[model samples]
Target: MTREPRSGCPIASTLDIVGDRWTLVILRDLLNGKSRFSQFLSSPERITTNILTDRLVAMESAGLVTKSPYQARPQRFEYKLTRRGEALLPILQEMCLWANAHIPGTWTPPVSFMARKPE
Candidate 1:
């Protein structure tokens, strides 16, 4: 699915790349320090292998994450967030706060994560 924005609005442009369920979940996992493919696979939401692969490729293309080979034999990789991706931290933090206040059963984000800055 091409994510070309329909207009030049900043929100619209960002949504073009991240307007999906899995992408932000993947971003959340990255922010929480999960890097390897298996680590992402272990999330409670239980993302499937195919979807994970596709999202990782999309994120790589969007310049949100970079993949580096950890194993040369089978070509395993670890995904690290780029500065662009790190810049989403505050947005995620605000979203978490909103969810905790308005959404029942939502847990508070960790203090460390709440206190963290992108830099």
Candidate 2:
């Protein structure tokens, strides 16, 4: 089944693909090089297994993430961001900077995080 576009605006069009909360969180982890399922699970945000599984599948279907098998016996999957997904880093950085400046008591991420070039 195909999903309809949320809006005609470019920003909205992009958000239609990655606006969900879990999707961004998943993307954030992937940006940090957290490729393994268990590593995503162990994040400070503590995502549930079922939700994580569903989000990963959705992202894969959306062409934002690609899943690859690392082991054959039990079949493990690792998630990595596609170029489209990696393109969100600048947006994420802007949001983080805005939150840090405008929101009270928001912990700041490292300067390196804000300055790091996308791969």
Candidate 3:
């Protein structure tokens, strides 16, 4: 697969992979320990199946996530963030903190959860 340009600027490069609204939400859900396909669907954001499928596929192609079949027969897939994907924890945490501080009625995440070192 052809890789997209990710170095027009450092931030641009980072955004190129995880910049879209849904992409970040996906990452956030994963960081919160949601791994299964249905779990992602059940997020409060209520993402549609088609969009979720597309985003998950894109993320997999971008090396941010991996899909493994955990069931036989019809086959069921579970999504897991790769080490590269986990690297975005700091970015997600910063954004979440900023939103909670500046946005009206933003719910605060657990301080301990945010303080934990990224795996």
Candidate 4:
């Protein structure tokens, strides 16, 4: 179920889905090719397991990701970006560039990430 956007403003509507503190960080991880639950946990932001679970479920519901069983014994899954998700790549890329340009002490994003365009 989609939440009502706060207004008709395009950016506000977009933020309605991706505005939370962890969502963009998680998106960066996904765009960087981390798909497994454990891989997400290993990110430097150190998201708690419960919050990670919440974000993944919300993202899946928002059609940003699709998960498939990767291990059947214990039913583990790996996630992949949907086309809708891939379309957010340039947003992340621009964020990286913006931060590197304006923020002090921020790690510069890799050339691969900077150059990557939305698929």
Q: What is the clash count of model 4?
A: 0
In candidate 4, what are the lDDT values of residues 1-119, reduced to their tens digit? Answer: 66877999999988988989898898888889999999999999999999999999999989999999999999999999999988998888888779888998899888888788777
- Candidate-wise lDDT, in order: 0.93, 0.84, 0.87, 0.90
Poorest 10 consecutive residues by lDDT, candidate 3: 1-10
Candidate 2 to truth, TM: 0.89
Instruction: Give me the runs in candidate 2 sitting further than 4 Å from their true place.
Output: none
- Give all TM-scores, in the order shown: 0.95, 0.89, 0.91, 0.94
Worst 10 residues of 4 by lDDT: 110-119
Give every collision pair in model 2. Answer: none
Estimate the overall C-alpha local distance difference test score of candidate 2: 0.84
For 1-119, candidate 3 gives per-residue lDDT tens digits of: 43777678988887788777799999888888899889999999999999999899999999999999999988989899899998888988898889988998988887765985678
Ranking by lDDT: 1, 4, 3, 2
- How far off is residue 80 in model 2, in Å? 1.3
Which ranges in model 1 have alpha carbons more than 4 Å from their true place? 1-3
Backbone collision count in every prediction? 0, 0, 0, 0
